[model samples]
Target: MSRVRIAAEIAGAAVLLVAAIGIGAFLREQRTEPQSPAAAPLAESLAAPTQRPQPNCAVLGQVTPVPVPPLATVDLANGKKSITSAEGGYTVIVPTAWLVQPGIIEGTAWFGQTRITSYDPKTLPRPGPEAPGILPPSFGISLDLQLWWNPKGEALDQFAQHMLIGPDQLAVLPGGVVSVGGKQAYRTTIQDQRQYQPATGPVITTRQTRIVWIVPTDRNDRVLVAYATPGESDLFPEVEKIVGAIVLTTPASPTLPVIHQRDEILGRWLYDKSGAPIAGRRAEAKLLTYGETVAAFGGGTGLPRIDRDPDELFWLVAVTGPDLPQGRGGPGGTSPPTAWIMYEAPATNDRYEGAGTRFASAGTWPADFDALPDRCR
Candidate 1:
């Protein structure tokens, strides 16, 4: 593989990271709506019950009453209670041992252990050489309810089908369709592994199970609820109960917007052979762009890699666009994407030039296109 191809792949990963923030913002703006006020009964019924349950007790609520109580004002160590955030549009009954906080931005909300108040994923300071791990380690188990706006008219199942799974990083378990809030959803289980290096200890491999719920929001976004637990633990049933009880106050729209920015660069591109018969050299590629980055899929020797061997191979590249000048408000100039090739690969162009040209066009994609991909169907 050529170094250019390797660099393109790395660029793709960086693009995905930056694009994620953009996607989050899009979801927030397009899909989110103010939730209806909590029902009156939801508040009165959620008050602490007269009888106290065991410390390990878990409570799930079917409805969120109005006049929502303030869990933050009361001490959680005393006993378990059902709480609802009228502003957030969902309710959860947490044990006295767990702490719950209302989401301040968009539809974000949190429920879990107390140590979280000081730790913020966005603002947390980086660990130096002496402390290379999260200063205060996170609890082995965590749960979060996230809402995303989906401007694309993609169903929950369709979204699942397009999910890019990195073969080397994650193992996805067989998942099937499930229902949430009376709407169809896709539920899947994923085994994720992370490598962390601490200053005082050798590298550590941590494994965890993530339960994912992707439900179409009926508008521009979808609601994604996730529950993560230690790989060896069985918290599915408990988590499911919590997920099953969620009710949305916002109504779903029947139609989606006619246009989306992603459609412009999402398609197939090719470099036709100059002069040849049926055996003429030809190259084809597919690209998907979201937010500020793009993901490339297809096989061809036209890609670049620093090292290569005799083995046949395919490639997936995630990359960002060329940076513009700082004053122009864009990523400043950066090296262009490169291509690589290997003999006997499933897909290959007659020459690297053809592939390189195709990739370059994709790297600096525009907002309009004269042709789209058949594969998009």
Candidate 2:
């Protein structure tokens, strides 16, 4: 080989040796470098042991069974009693322990009767007279009225107003929603003062009232189940458990018509104490039939009064209208009813008018003849 070529080859070999040394140094540095602290495990401790859930006392509490009582024993003349004739167009199992009573105002198809029964004192409060601790059991037949007409929330507010609470009234707590009696329901708890009559003085008993509003699926029907106790605490858990056990099987179809015969009498008309009509002025009449008997009243000149009752055999005055304003007097507001007083009874005549009262007048008829509107005709 030429001397210059040999010198070039030697220089190339020296450069290759330097490159190999540099690569080896870089790899060695990489292998010996310390790892970042963040990459290391935070601690050598083991993970926390799995926690056991706390036991719920409500679920564990012993349930008190409701006592059964005879129907005759429950029906004490003054006490109300009603038997379950129908349930959802099906036969129902009569609750052996409960005593049913006819509603104070009877004859509506939707409302049958109220139910009454005493619960275990351990589970409920003991009954005492004069603001007694006794629970006045009640039941309602489902009506097809508009549900939106009376919202459960608003109804609950009304119930709260009627309830008597304790001196140390606790705050009301919302319990959310739950299923009750196979129906959707909202549950809530309220702490209130219950008035109790003591031999010495009036005692204010602290209590918790649990309310459940059940909205039916088929109709605008709703069932309200309420349980109250003497304490400033929650009774929902127990109340729900007890109410859930209630099996309300439908009863047999009523032999009598679903709507009583008297329902026909419930409408607007005019009448007097003798069933006589007042001349020159007409009074709006309304009838409310319950069961076999009927209640009729007339208003417009003033609030209505009971006019007649074929069954009751006498006229009974029920309610009176308020005094009219100066210019807004009489049925037309042109003049006050002269000796014109609204009256209600079981019977009345066609024409009977006195001074200050016009006997002849014309007015619009109600839309429905079967029943009167809730407001004045």
Candidate 3:
């Protein structure tokens, strides 16, 4: 919603684009770490397969696994595989033929016939703020998915209704609850307008419908899965195939525990709503993984290694002090982040000595950025 952003290509996402969920692969859990380059297995040796790092929201520390592996490396031409959201701590068994990639924003990921790459969501060299009636094109037809925490514990249908009003959205068809993994999921379709004018040809216009599905998790978090395609495509079967197989957690899956286990870790540093560490404790923090950070304000090049992820969102929070803060950095505001150096768990605070980080939050990203009053931006 700012001049510069990586995701949120669609308009009017009031709360739709704030992704905060992760899913494993088609395997959805029951561990089986994928193979790596150097650690080739021996012919007759029994080393017990390398285990996947238990998914969790604790400080990842300075040296996370070198090849954390690109977000979506395994391309299944056809079959099944596990896709983890890592951010939201969920897993789904999607069709391997689908190219899986991180969602447009953090706490989100998606699968489809095409992969979104080679262009910047923040700035397109061709010039953006694209004309109306024409939605930005993607690699090909894709089904995007992501979910944010549901604080008030709203019912699935209520949440779906709130997600339908996008900026370009033209109409909302009636929808109702459907079964997915035995869970009640709200399914609906929004009529959206799009167009394209080529230099050498007449303007090409196509009718597209954003088919959306909203499902509630046992965790009180709501998940949104959308596939924007021509109105004629019958995606219900495939969509059901993907959403029907979601698994929230498995015995082997590493989960971001509500509280970090180690106190010495930056997570141990505690703070109050006013942004101050407990009276005698020092302030400290660490960078966040998808599960704890927003893709728009995510990792970028040239940033402190500690503060960068993939650099999707090109915004930085700069608070003047505890008294007069600026940017979307204030609680209930939309500021990016305040600390990179010292932070508590769920780690995405953008912080420093004068600025302390908050461990609790109403939502991720702006609502959770720590050190809201100390950074210079």
TM-score winner among the candidates? Answer: 3
Ranking by lDDT: 3, 1, 2
Cα deviation of 230, candidate 3, in Å = 4.7
* Runs of candidate 3 exceeding 4 Å displacement: 1-80, 86-89, 95-97, 105-140, 164-166, 194-206, 224-231, 234-237, 250-377
> For candidate 1, which ten residues in a row score worst on lDDT?
341-350
Candidate 3 per-residue lDDT, tens place, 1-377, comes to 22333222433221322211111121122022322222122211211211232233334332233222234344455676666544333566665655455644333322111123223333433334334333345423345555443445777666655554334556767888777556678878877754567777677654456666666654553343444443344544555566567655421223222233223232222333344443322222233343233321332211111122221111122111111111223676444322212122232231111112221212212333444321111
In terms of lDDT, which candidate is strongest?
3
**Greater-lDDT candidate between 1 and 3:** 3
What does the lDDT read for residue 346 in candidate 2?
A: 27
Preferred candidate (TM-score higher): 1 or 3: 3
Which is the winner by lDDT between candidate 1 and candidate 2?
1
How accurate locally, in lDDT, is each candidate? 0.33, 0.28, 0.37
TM-score per candidate: 0.37, 0.35, 0.43
Candidate 2 global lDDT:
0.28
Off by more than 4 A, model 1? 1-88, 102-140, 161-169, 195-204, 234-236, 251-377
Error of 3 at 260 (Å): 15
Per-residue alpha-carbon lDDT of candidate 2 for residues 21-125, written as tens digits (9 for 90 to 100) = 543342234223422323112211211211232222232122243222221223335433223323322111223443233221122122222222232222344
Error of 3 at 157 (Å): 1.6
Weakest 10 consecutive residues of candidate 3 by summed lDDT = 19-28
Candidates, ranked, TM-score: 3, 1, 2
